[model samples]
Target chain A: MAEIVGAYFTSHVPSIGGAIHRGLKQDPYWKPFFDGFPPVHEWLAKVKPDVAVVFSNDHGLNFFLDKMPTFAVGAAPEYANADEGWGLPLYKTFKGHPELSWHIIEGLVEEEFDPVTCQSMLVDHAISIPFELAYPDAEQWPIKLVPIGINTVQHPLPSAKRCLALGRSVHKALASWKGDERIVVIGTGGLSHQLDGERAGFMNAEYDRFCLDNLVSDPDALTKDSIHEIVRLAGTQGVEVLNWIAARGALGPGAREIHRNYHLPISNTAAATVLYEPA
Target chain B: MPSELEPIPGTTLFDGEAARKGYALNALCFSFNEKVNRDAFLADEAAYLARFNLTPEQHEAIAKRDVLGMIAAGGNIYYLAKLAGIFGLNVQDVGSMQTGVSVDKFKAMLLAQGRGESYEVAHKEMLNG
Candidate 1:
């Protein structure tokens, strides 16, 4: 049976991608943010999970307002990256794990979490930046990917509790996989930064710290807060913390926080990364 | 009609109704994802919007480059960011527009209270005043 190794959480801020693509990692404004990734690289080298189940919100890449799936799973053999109109360089097609994807989708539905399964989806910066940040040297990602899309663009988004439950379902499905595989579930986005309205360029370092501490030690307590409160406190884009909570749920509680890095104002985002290994 | 679910006062919730009203405008903004389209819009702003069959309100919102007006007219922030980027406008600029404050003040507000007070204090002020 496939054994779940751990989960990783990180921000996929597009500016981080721009800095890396433009080779401005050493530039003063971006150097601190870039400096935070080496520990992740070192940790990845150590555990080296064979598969990464990524939770990200699409920024009008594949799904627009036409039909936004609350939860979309990529079951394709491969997923492509695209330029999200800002001239961000595209990465090579990411290989997918269709068998595991299908199993997980089926299990999620059985577990009462209806997922919109996609055989083809163009991934945007939300996934690409983190990929580059983590595996900077690879022409292609070293591990197979299972891209899961969560709707954070449109309102009426799934609650943190629901996202957590969905993560639990993902864990249940992964546990049922009969093949030998080491896996990582990654929830990407949010350290309390807002990107629009009069309140744009918002960051709450204190709130972000509260989130990090609670996410590691007391996630359910964090889950109790409503999205309204989260939006009020964390800012609109900060709602992406729900993705982090989902990643925590996939690990099924009692995972030890192995590594974390939090940095601010990376192109108007409170960037963060956390790694959890099962205790 | 607004959603039966009571509206959050300070928000323009992008629910189904907003999506329907803003479909053409968002589709137009979504086109800006391609470099050619962003160039075309920059080259001839009027002609670019004409291609989308936008409502007069949407055209006005785009014409004035009003981020708040665009949101009120059903523009999603992610799509609007592309449009804003064309003018060298960043998220903070759009945010300042929405908050009805100068960019400097907006940044300062973020540093001070974030959105912790926006919904409760600002919205109440907007609603009452």
Candidate 2:
């Protein structure tokens, strides 16, 4: 049967792509973080999952104002690569597993979480960034994907509570899928810090640490906090922590903080690589 | 090439007023009428600016509609489309409406028909950016 053999929590900062693409890794400032992330790179290379169910918020490519779903799963077979300004150097289309994608979609719906399904779409960084760095070649890293686009970009987005509930639903949905291949659930985006206006340089190491600590043990407390609290502490866009909570919730209490790293100088926010569920 | 967005069909996008509020809120901040809303926003630019730690030039790009520059300024694609919609342009089109046409071909058709006859402040990228 299909199983979530593993789960990963990461921060997919777009500028990181800019930094790496520009060969900034050797730059004194960014070198440290990349050093911390290599083990994560190795883990993904090893797990080599059959499919990656990604959770991220669009910066606006796939869904726009006409309609934005709090949560949408891509049932599409293909997604085009977008030139996300800093130039997403690695560009190749993402292949979606329509069969598994729709199965998760139907399952989520049956669980009462109405998720939108896109048959054709253009995925922005949310799906591409980690993907580019994690899975560069189609033949080797042939992990089909199921993208769960969250509305973290929009305000009054689903509450931390709602997102966790949805995560729990995802756990149940996948739990019942009968397949032999292994799957990896990845929650991309966030630790503290807001990168906008006067808040551009805001960094909350205290909150970042606390959140990471609880993520392995008590996720409900974080998920129960109001959006207002999350924004007040992490900045408005920082609420993307909801994605982290959802990932933890799906990984269930079986998760272990196998690995954790934080680097904020590159950007005000923290970047971490956490492994959940012992294989 | 459909007359309207095919309704994304069965998803509950939101419950009741939630979706409406999202659209209205987005429109209020990013729509062409942003100026009208700015009076209220301006009352407390500090609070507004604090939400997004943008540089002055960055703020100007968003206010000015330098699409590409705005993207570099840290703006996302959705709000960019909202800005486009405010300028009487569709999100998919480029310099001339004739450039990016789709099912809403009529909107593009109407836009291309009026080409350079009239202009809006937000329509000029070089002047603004």
Candidate 3:
């Protein structure tokens, strides 16, 4: 059976991808943000998960408002990274493990989750940014990917309780895989920062820290938080916290936070990163 | 009637109803993902919108460059950002437009809240009455 080697959570702000692409990592404004990833890099090197089941939300790449699937999983051989019309350079395609993806999808559907399955997709910065951060200097991504796309954009999104349940389903699915593979689960976006309305540029580091603490020590506390509460306090885009909640759920209760970093003001976001290992 | 669902103050919920209303306009905005399409739209705004067969309200909203109106007309913010990008408006600029404040003032309000301001209040005051 496949073993889940590690779980990680991080903010996938597009501008950080811009800094990495334009050779601006050393710039004073971005250095702190860039500095947080090296430990994560070290962790990835140590664990060396054969595949990463990434939990990220799309920012208008494939699904426009027309048919926003609350939970979608990519079951393709390769996933392309595309320009998001924001001038960021496209990264090389990441190889996908379709067999493993389908295993999880089947397990999810059996468990009553009903995740929308896609055979092709061009991922936006949410997927690309985290991929770049993990393997900064690779000619091609060194790790394979299975993307779990969620909807944190439009309203009436899946609830926190539902997201947590989905994560548990993902964990159960990974466990039932008969193949001999090691895997990691990753969630991206949020540690408090909003990107729209008069509340644009909202960053609550204290709330972010609270979230990080509970996410590690008492993540169940988070499931109690409602969509409105998160939106009002964390800013509307803060709904991406659901991605993190799902990752935490995938890691299961005994997973301990191994490394964490939180930083502020990265292009209208309060960024954070954490790694969880089975305790 | 008075029993209808109450709308959240200061926000537009892009739920199912709004998603249906804004589908065509958003699809038109989605087309701007390609640089060629963005350039085409910029070269002739009305012509580009006409291709989408947008409703008069959506066409008017696009013509006026009104973000809030577009949202009211069923425009998703993420898709609308493409249109906003064409006009060199960033998130803060959109927020300023939405709030009817200057960008500088809007930015200052964000700053006044403090970067580390943890939400101490309960959900009732923060989300609804």
Candidate 4:
């Protein structure tokens, strides 16, 4: 059976991609955020997992309002990243793990969680940025990918509770897999910042701190807040923390946090990176 | 009866109601992902916008480059971002535009929040103290 090695929770703010492209990591404004990743890189070097199952939200790149799926999982042989209208340079294509993706899709269905399965998906910065942050210099990415997109764009989003359940189902699927691949679950997006409305620049470090603490010690406690409450406490875009909640959920109970870094105002976001290993 | 969500101040929920209203506007912005579409839109803005079934208000909002106006006309920030990019406006630029602040001031506000200098955080500290 495949073993779930750990989980990573990160913020996928697109500007980070631009900064990397411009070689601005040491620039005073971006240094703190960039500084958070070296530890993650060292950890990845130490415990190399074979596959990464990423939980992220697409920012109008692949899916549109024409047909938005609450939850979509990728089963493609390869996933490509293209222009997201901001002129961020295209990233190298990612290899996929179709066999595991299919197993997880079936497991989600059996667990009463319906997910749209995609055999051809174009990943956006949400997946690309985090991968780049984790493996900054890889000529070719070391791990296979299984991208799971949760809808954070439109309202009527899956509750944090529901997202946690989805992650647990993923855990079950990975545990039951006939192969022995080591897997890491990644949840990308948010700590707290709103990019629209009169509250366009809203940032809540206090709420973000609360979430960071609770995400590890008491994930269920974090889920107690309804979607509306999360929007109020975090900001509108800050609600991307749903990706974090789902990633934490996949770690199962007794997961210990090994490392965490939080920095604010990373291009209209309170960026954070957390790594959790199963106890 | 379906319970209504209590509205958050200065925030639009982008629920079904807004999604339905903004479909054409969002669809138009979504097309900007391609360089050809971006160039086409730049060449003849009105004609390109006309290709979509945009509401009168949405069309006006785009014409004026009014960020808040676009939001009121049912634009989701995610999609509006693409349109903003076409005009070389980043989030901070539009943020300052909407908030009646300079870009530097808007950025300073964010830096203050990061440093725990915002009113909300200060108020919490006072209460706790």
Top DockQ prediction, candidate number: 4
Which digits, one per residue and each the tens of the lDDT, describe model 4 over residues A33-146?
Answer: 999999899888988998999999999999999899999999999999998997889998999999999999999999999999999999999999999999999999899999
* DockQ for candidate 3, C-alpha atoms: 0.34
Docking class of 3: acceptable
Model 2, residue A141: what's the lDDT? 43
**Global fold similarity of model 4 (TM-score):** 0.97
Q: How many backbone clashes does candidate 4 have?
A: 0
Off by over 4 Å in 3: B1-9, B100-129
Under CAPRI classification, how is model 2 graded? Answer: incorrect
lDDT, each prediction = 0.80, 0.62, 0.80, 0.89
True-vs-predicted CA distance for residue A189, candidate 4, Å? 0.4
What is the alpha-carbon RMSD of candidate 2 to the true structure?
15.5
DockQ of each: 0.38, 0.04, 0.34, 0.71
TM-score of each: 0.90, 0.69, 0.90, 0.97
After the best TM-score superposition of candidate 2, give how far the Cα of residue A34 lies from its true spot, in angstroms: 0.7
| Candidate 4 segments whose C-alpha is farther than 4 A from its true place | B119-129
Tens digit of per-residue lDDT, candidate 1, span A1-279:
676778888888777776887899999867777787888898889887899898889998788887889999999998898767766677778899999999999999999888999999888888877888889999778999898888988877888889889988888888788988889888898878777655555567777888899887688877887777788768788899988888888887678888887776666677888888887
**Compared with the real two-chain complex, what DockQ does model 4 have?**
0.71
Writing each residue's lDDT as its tens digit, candidate 2 over A1-279 gives 876778877788766777766878778767766776677777877776788877888765566666768888888888776543222454567777888877788888888998887898777766676765565444434777788888886555788888888888887878887876688888888866444332233345567778888877778878766666677666545677888887776665567776777775444445666777643
True contacts kept of 1: 0.42
